[model samples]
Target: MGVQTNPCLVVLAAYSLILIQANITPVLAHVINQTESPATAAPQAPPPVAPVAPVRSAMQPLQATDLLTADKPCSHGLERQMPYFGMGAPGPSGSAGIPGLPGAGGAQGARGERGDRGEPGLSGFPGSKGDKGDIGAVGPQGLVGLEGLNGTKGVKGEPGRDYTPPSMSAFHVGQSSNLQVTSGSQIISFNAQYINIGDDMSQHTGVFTCRIPGLYYFTYTFRAYSHGSYGLNIDLLVNNVVKSQIYMTAMSKHLMQTQSTIVTLRVGDDVWLKANANTYINGDDEMNVFSGYLINAI
Candidate 1:
């Protein structure tokens, strides 16, 4: 008379005898050898200890069945809880840990705004060519540049011929013993020279100093013989300005006076032939002539 058990069916029969893989010491030694074989006796119900009200399963999957209801025990000794769990049986595999300590490095961002030029990458396999380097040491002579802005003025040249027109100036003179000119104005001495080409005429000062500088052509011829009242003033100075002159007044005899000129000399101009006041001039052969040349040479 003492068996009032019902602690939620004794915790579903002790969780189905701890997932029964059948070794609760061989199921309690076959229930103690069937109660000592006394005709298969049965009087063993002592496992309740009373502390229930905490049933929350339905979290299935760990099966191996049998949640109590053996033979039959109702009304108060309760034995009616069924259906549960299913897959379980996978254990043995542990040992390989201890490797954690590496986390702290994040704060270096903000220099990004130059992207969008990609899509050209697939051509790699060409690297094997290096051996040629030795020639460097020649520098220092470069600081003369700033004179380049004057090139646009060319194309107008062609007018110089094959010529020969200098004609070496000329001269001719005569006057060996100019008869008489009593020093009131003199220099009519042409000590006779025939053609002094660029030995620029000066037979003892009958001057002709125009070493080439333009048209010149002078001529003079004088011879005046007298017996009473006579005159023969001749002049052709050029630098003493009397470019050409001749006067042959005679009240007696021989008279000859010729004058020709076209002078325009420059280079230190100074031509000559002069006799005035008591002028007489009577010489022979080629008379008292003086001539000049160079007609064009400016």
Candidate 2:
């Protein structure tokens, strides 16, 4: 079996070497005196020791004879020296030292994580009112509204002063003279009375005088035959002013014509029919007539 080498022998050998270098060799001197002659006895030479191979080799066995009892071989290599003892046991740890000055500041650390959000703040006070602006342009007109309801009926009006029973102040007169010749531009004095309500007409003068202040409608018809190229022409006058007229050419036989007008008249206003120069009217069995009637009163 191989020998188990001891580790304590290595520590003891290192301790002995440290003491010898520091010149603390009193114990070493005593050990040498036990194996050598006194220094004053005589200058004696010591015996030599030959180098020996290490005993740790597998083939070699450790023996007591390898360690010399008398003298350590100083001429031998230090590595050849034998390990005799273990290092002294470690001393107790010393007391804590005084504190030192603070060290220099280190490099800046990494950024930290983000913090949580904060709560909302209270609402602020309301602001003051602003000044008024200029007026805007007018907008487009709106659509028309629906029609309104009919009004109430009015009271019945009183009869007019010149009005009589069958009709109002009105007249229808005719002339049946088969051929009435015109001496000049004169009034046609009609002689036949078909209707003369209120007697507001004059058969002699051929004029109707108004007795009411109102609008009146007048119409007349004449049956006639043209004699020559000077066609028949007639006039209906209101107060000496021509209000209506008609003309006929000589190219036809007996025929008929009509003319009508509306006018606003006051009391004493005259309305009449007159034949112009060179005009003839037929009787047509008394069908030639002139008429007038009040339509509205002021």
Candidate 3:
């Protein structure tokens, strides 16, 4: 009876030993109570609550090369290569570009080679005479400065001479020295015992004829009282050179003695009084001319 011989291998060995005792001892008792049962599994629905998508504050970009590196990318707020920044984004529109063609005028620049004249700068040390300038506002007196050009006249002074004529003719008679004659021998007179017999007389002349030209002084006289008593010859010819000459000689007692010639004649002169007789005496005979004449003219 082998139990009905293999009866389904004993019900498949008792269903494999009850599924190895219900799944290997509950998978070794869940690996020995996985750290003591971390709160029993199947209530994990908290993980599906992942919809918190609002944490987005990432707009800090702009880094042209490595400008301090803070992530990078900004377009409307402009920073791709950096030239525009914007609140309204309307800021950077400035580059128009084209219309270019006018360029040929550039060649005139080559004339600069003459520069070596710089070494004369050291003569500047004479500057200290400057403080006397403020007196200039009176300028209206300028027309009088043109009168200085006249000076040349001096050399003519040497001529003034002539006055030298006087050789002799002087008369000063205070009276008396008689040559008186009358008794009708043609008018002549003088008699008072023949006054003061001429004393110291002198006369000289070459010509005479100016009857009234004022200022004349002429005189001539001769005397005698004891020399021979008498001899007389008298001559006085003016303008004819005989100025005076007289002589009386010879024991002639005294022939009316008196010899004198004086002249101060001015009005048409031609005086004539001459006596001639060598010797004779006796209170007689002629010899006349007394107080001759005198005519003064201005």
Candidate 4:
């Protein structure tokens, strides 16, 4: 009675409210369980995200038109070209290299031409003479060579002077003095002379002296007149020595004898006649003569 509602309408309204409560209650219960038991909940997959691009400066992009066109101002468009790098100057000369090993010897060269001849040298001095050698043995005689022509005759020589022979002579006696008959020897004195050349005869000594040495000839003649029986002997003496003798025996008559001889006389020699003792001589000038002469000079 309060308004006395229709019954059907009221049932319908309650039913509709019940349906809304059923759906709202499940949703609320699910949220409550997730909050209470997170470990037990299934993980959810995240959504897909886009890739990030590289960071870029705030510059404009380059283009072929900006590079080709020189007059255009492209300050932030073209990238600044890097500066070209050139090779540097050659480095300082390296240090001197080490000395290398010696090379092989070279081949022999060709021979040179011959030189000109030299001048002649001066002569040497002569050497001294050597000593004489010893005499060698005598060799056999060699054959004689042919004779040469004869020479002309020479002039004649002068004639030599002639030589004269020594001359001496004694001839006759001038005086008679010896007239005795004695027993001993005595000299007969022919007291005179005729030719006594060279004055070699002496009248006083009754001797003939030789002036020159020579060969001489002597002659003596004696005449003895004796009264009684007596022997008369005469000797020719040379230098007081008897060289020759003459002997005669007279009974009464006068006896005459002549004797001649040759004798070699030296200088200063003497010749004289001596009578024997016991003989008498009549000293007569004509009979008793003693003479001598040089035949040749010695």
Candidate 5:
């Protein structure tokens, strides 16, 4: 018969159809690589959606004539009018606000505009020294000076008014004669008289006269003796001039002499005591003598 089929059921139905195509082959190759790629692959931006608040319908409270007709102005664009409420342009100036509280001090302002001129200062130091005062008062008186010089020359005076003082006075004479003669001049005459007080003395001629008128003072004394070779002399006159003298030679064998004088008489002066020319004389009882006195009356 042509009819006999069972080869083991045809090898177990082809082994289960190859295990069902190996388990569907990666899901059909991922759906065929997603339907053949590129439909311009750049279309995936759909995730930021947060805008949902616009459902408003509840604000209706206005009356003051509806805010004065809502201060109108917006007519043509949306075409229905009257519902304005404006007041907006002032908003940008608000950032400077927090400073307010300092206002009440205004009235002292009007005196200000005069200020520019300063720079030039530095130089100071020097002061120290004081102390010393007190002393004043005393003045006035001065003027006068000059004058001096002249002196010398003096001496000699005494004899004033009409002078007159004198009392004549006199003395004359010899005693004891041994009058050897060998002479040529003689005036030895005295017959012995002692004092002639104002009789002014004149023993014959051994004179002594002066009657007052000046200064007078006279005196004389003498004695002599010489023999073999013989020589002797004596004299003492005044008015007949020969004031005084006495001598002895032959080797002087005993001779003696004395004399004195001061004369200025003028009323008839005359005093004497003479002998000379081979003269010789020897007397004793008071020797040969003559004297006179009267001093001062000129």
Candidate 6:
């Protein structure tokens, strides 16, 4: 049996062994479909993956869904994570941030309960009663009403100089005994009371110039007859100026008088005579100077 093999070379050796088993059956099924499957053990092909930058654990807190989880890393990725979408509904609530500094003074708030009486103001109409005061003056005629006494025997009046006759009257008008004054100037001298004109009108020196102009109560009598004499720049001239000046006294023949000034005269007021005749001394006497009024303050 071993001597026959040439039936066309045994069909070309079984068609070249079926064309090399059909090219080794697709190279053994492409090595069994690139072969790692003995219960799935050959997929170790994931080593070229280098985009992993999300390992933040400095004591961990990175969970915004683990920042786009892919084991957290598309190079810090939750799809490049920054999409919180939460600001749209809160736009109307942002106007209250300026009140933080007044918090330290808040412990005194418990005293408020007394306010319920405010509704009664409309009834005013009655005020008019005041007028009754004047009825008082009928009393003067009762000393038992009468006069009965006549037992006569008296007449001894005349004792030289106990003088007191001046309800008011005086005058002086230059027959010059001294008159020359000028310093805050004022000069008015008069002396007169002549109903009987006797002692040369009793010590003569009277000039009566202003006849009638209403108010005229005045008096200025001055005399400093020696020792550094000074008194009488007599100022009480109503319309010719200088209304008040008559003060003199380092006196000698001393006759300083002034205090009855109530003037209002106006009609060429020429109250004359002012003497500072350097302290006049020819028998010291700025001779009885006078001016008067007060027949009732004028």
State TM-scores per candidate: 0.24, 0.44, 0.18, 0.44, 0.20, 0.17
RMSD of each: 19.7, 17.8, 32.6, 41.2, 39.3, 30.1
- How far is 123's C-alpha from truth in model 1 (Å)? 14
- Candidate 1 stretches greater than 4 Å from native: 1-27, 32-170, 174-183, 187-193, 196-214, 217-236, 239-271, 275-291
**Segments in model 6 whose C-alpha atoms lie over 4 Å from true places:** 1-212, 223-225, 228-273, 276-298
Per-residue lDDT of candidate 2, residues 107-173 (tens digit): 9999999999889888889889889999999999999999999999999998869856443788888
The C-alpha stretches of model 3 lying farther than 4 A from their native spots are: 1-170, 173-221, 225-230, 241-249, 252-256, 259-294
Better of 3 and 4 by lDDT: 4
Give the Cα error of residue 180 in candidate 2, in Å. 4.9
Q: How many residue pairs clash per model?
A: 1, 2, 15, 6, 0, 12
Q: Which one wins by TM-score: 5 or 6? A: 5
TM-score of predicted structure 4: 0.44
Worst 10 residues of 2 by lDDT: 68-77
For 99-144, candidate 6 gives per-residue lDDT tens digits of: 6665576688999999999999999988798788799899887767
lDDT of 5: 0.63
Candidate 2 error regions (>4 Å) = 1-167, 179-183
- After TM-score superposition, the amount by which residue 220's alpha carbon in candidate 2 deviates from its true location, in angstroms, is 0.3
Which residue window of length 10 is worst by lDDT in model 5?
73-82
lDDT of 5 by residue, 1-298 (tens): 5998664455446544744554565556655665666473554443434333232223543345332232443233211222423344555655676888999997887888899888877867877776766766666666666665665666767868896854656565664675544657787677678788888777887777777778877776767756656555767777878876776765447777777878787777787777766766676748766667776767
Question: In model 1, which range of ten residues has the least summed lDDT?
Answer: 53-62
Compared with the true structure, model 1 gives a TM-score of: 0.24
